[model samples]
Target: MIKQKRRYFSFLFVLPLLVVFLLAGCQLQDQFNAAMSRLAATQSVAGPTLEATKAATSEATVIATAAQTATAVANSTLVLWVPPQFDPNGETLTGKLFNQRLQQFEASFPEYTVEVRLKSENGRGGLLDSLSNASLAAPATLPSLVLLQYRDLESASLKGLIVPLDEDTLNVIGQNWLPYAGQLSEIQHNLFGVPFAGDALALVYRPAQTPYPPSTWQELSTQNLPILFPAADPDTLVVINIYQTAGGSLTDENGEPHLDTDPLLKTFSYFSNGAQSGAFPIWDTQLADFSSSWSLYQQQSSGYAIVWASQYLQGQLPGNELTSLPEINGQKITYAQGWLWAIPQGSSQSLEGARHLLDYLSEPEFVDQIDQLAGYLPVYQSGLDAQTNPDLKATLSELMNSAQPLPAGSTINSISPIMESSTLQIIKQQIDYIQAANAAANQFK
Candidate 1:
């Protein structure tokens, strides 16, 4: 009976050892299967991994090295913040094109991957607002790069929300960039943004109704056809155009606004007289925004209107003629604005990687695609010449020559409301041109 008990105890000990051995074997098999699966998937996509094998390495060392390499590649990622207009999940044409470009960018740079976040273009809770919130609340979540309009660069830079581009980076882009594009990116002599897309003001007129298109504001004001323009829009581009055309300076020597000058009075008087003479339709009251003014032009309610190049491109206005704003003192001048690629101050991505991606996107080839798909003009001069569409090419060429980068410190947000109110008062005949211009100018002071 003692010998039987000893055998049974021995059996129990052996049984536990056997169970441990089985469990270990199963774990080894699982790890082996996972490694093999990963290898197979890599080979299928990348075609035979370029991993080098050491002549005298053990199997365990090889596995460890491969695992480390995979982890490293998995961690290389970039996050980009774009407007909702470029959201890949959306059905818009630009969205699809941007997604395709993003895929190509990833394929071209195998070591890095990109994730896109969509943000609203405008509003209290928009891209800029979100950036402000993120900067204050959780800066770690800020994007590696952001696409923003030219007007935002000054405010963003002043607030320390974006980093300035180094001279070397600027040199690389400056080689092929248009003069205005470079100018658009500069803030107090520092480059804080890289121009990607551009828009300029142009005159959109119906050729059937008006055989001759006016070349200057003076001529446009004297025309018999009911001229329409966004005189009341908050952008105040029309006001700027007129003010500049009449030899008015946008700012004084102290960088204060020079709105009450003789040139401004003359420009205002031209518009006020036009309103009283029935040359300009009383559409300012109805046109509180560009879209409303554009709608009026689109519905053929007016013979001519001033519009952005994008609007003209999108409208494909039939039987219409597009020309640079009428020549003032034999000089054609128009305001130009652009969207830029800016790196936020607290981005987690390596500067080298972010710059590489931006340079790739700014290539002439990529800019060409953007111009073709989106209505924005290319930042490169060569891209404009390469356009296949004759009409578009001619119009862009003329505008490009006359295009002036929006003046620094001339943010429309601050100046628009004042200009809009003054212009509206003048149009309503409630205030004389001198009085209105002085009032608008004083607000800036």
Candidate 2:
């Protein structure tokens, strides 16, 4: 009986040790399986990875994943807001081309969906006012991207809405964009926005009619023909351009308003004296419609007209016979500046995504399409150089190289209204005075 009890106690102690060993073995197996599963996953994507492949993939996967994430994040649906200048449905050349390009952007980057909204505001639809109001109620109501006219930069920028581009972004843009674009990006030594389009203005003339582009006010007056230029509110910018070309200063060295009497007198005297002598076509009083001038040029009713580059190229202006503004004492002067594409500060999307879209839009492939259909010169040098069509290429090259960019700093817009009103007043006075002077001369004769 005593021997049987000793054996039972010894068996009880051994059984507990055996159970502990079994539990430890199961735990080790579970840990091993988990590690093996991770290894298998890495091997599948990493191509049967050996020890050497592990280090390489650590770096490679990091880079690959980063690139994929960037593309994916930016490719998510993008929304763009355009002003009335672009009509997606109109038969206008700019309208047709912009739509096609929008399609192309979607096709090329399928990861991204682009939605373009055209908000047509009448003359009173102040972009700044509308955008400011929308942003307040629903901040997301503002589109991820906005198209701003070159003239509107101040009102837009001053509202603390535009984001400053960093060094990396500027580097990529510098590699791919035009000279003027990069230069304009820097505002007071800090870069703010990228230039998207140039609405350049030059003298549009019929080579057969004039035989020579007018170089001076004296030459233009001597032609004994009607000279035309845009002066209406839609194209009121022409007044500013003419003032600049005639040696009038829009802004002083320190960026102060400098639209003075001397410059106004010079500009008005040229037009008023010409009008009184019947040198200007009295019938062509309005410059609101480019077609009017185009009709005149095409019908040989006028020798020369000043027009926007886009109008001149797209047949909106009559004379296919075109040339740049003639030199004033051997110096070329033209008015040029247009809308720029930008993502406003505090927009819905991340800054990097906004920048990526900007980079894509400014790409050579996209810009060439815009240039081809719209007849606007490509702001990208690479795109312009890559232009294959002989006629289109030749025309754009001549304009881009010779064209002058308009100065569109903040001070310029603030004083434009004043300048416009003052200039017109001066012109009216000069015309009345010149008419009286001419009548007196006739009486004496």
Candidate 3:
């Protein structure tokens, strides 16, 4: 019995150790299964995580590249060469309005910027003269665009300083422009510039003195009122006015001067008789430019005066009436000119950007605003239709429709001085009208 008890106690002790070993084995098996499950989950998720990370990195790279490209595009700029007459800092009304329009242009075109350089409109150090110098000195420094007078078109084109506008650009600009507007930019059947403003010769008189505006030269000659015009001015438009009214043309179909014609003779005769008869003011010889004649007229020195439409608009000639030139042979004729926008040769700006700015400037809305603000005749019919003053609109419409462009050619540069000298001689009684006409015409030959 004692031996049996000892064996039983030993067995119990061995049972506890075997139970502990079995528990440890179970724990090890459980740990192994959990580790296997974690490994399997990691393997399944790894491919998708890597792909998602790659997609995020690619998207970020694309976004960064797009931003860089946009920044580059936004940094582009356009440079414009304009006259101080349209100065933004000027005290004139047109100057103030021009600056406003410039601001609007800049705001509307956020992707591009504008830099303006002031240039002289006339004289030895004028815009074209400066451009010619720059072309010779440093062609690369030329402006992308230039504001030019209609008279400058012929010379600028001959010099190859400006580029002809493409057909696509012309088409986009549309065909609603005025007759003279298009004519100003048309050179050798090719379009070169865009017209911005229209100016014409018109008679300005105080309404109180002349309730009846003369429609014919006979009626005007009969009035006995002293007429004021820029007889001594270098611009030939005054001479052309009388010549054209008398059915004379300054240029032949080939753009050559036809100065000694019967029409010119008649025009000179009319002016000489009028001046000698005391119908035309003798003081006009002292008038150097339109401004001087305009000043004299403003002082009520004469009953009638020929002045530019631009001056009439600028002066706002209150209590004054505007009309076309006196009729000859029942036909009225006048000279019209324009300021044009043109791109210089070898512009650094991208064509797209330059075209965008040109398009913006030619918009009818902007043109209308310019008309209202500056008294410049609108280039578009829509602008004309928007005018609040019916009489002014009608007058401008009639003048715009009937007005002819000044003859454009190399000969044009010489035509003015010759005409001026002949007219001055006839008025001064130094030569008879026929002699003056013959002498002037011979110079063109």
User: Which candidate number has the best TM-score?
Assistant: 1
307-406: candidate 2 lDDT, tens digit per residue: 6777776654444455666545455566566667767766775455456667676666666667656666567787677778675567566655655555
Q: Rank the candidates by lDDT, best first.
A: 3, 1, 2
Ranking by TM-score: 1, 3, 2
TM-scores of the candidates are: 0.80, 0.67, 0.79
lDDT of 2: 0.61
- Candidate 1 wrong stretches, greater than 4 Å: 1-74, 89-93, 169-172, 409-417, 438-445
lDDT of 3 at 223: 64
Off by over 4 Å in 3: 1-75, 89-108, 170-172, 252-255, 442-445
Error of 2 at 158 (Å): 1.7
Q: Is candidate 2 or candidate 3 better by TM-score?
A: 3
Report clash pairs, candidate 1: 215-326, 216-326
Report the lDDT tens digits of candidate 3 across residue range 150-213: 7776578778888989967544354578777777778777778888777888888777878878
TM-score: model 3 vs. ground truth: 0.79
Per-candidate total of colliding backbone pairs:
2, 4, 0
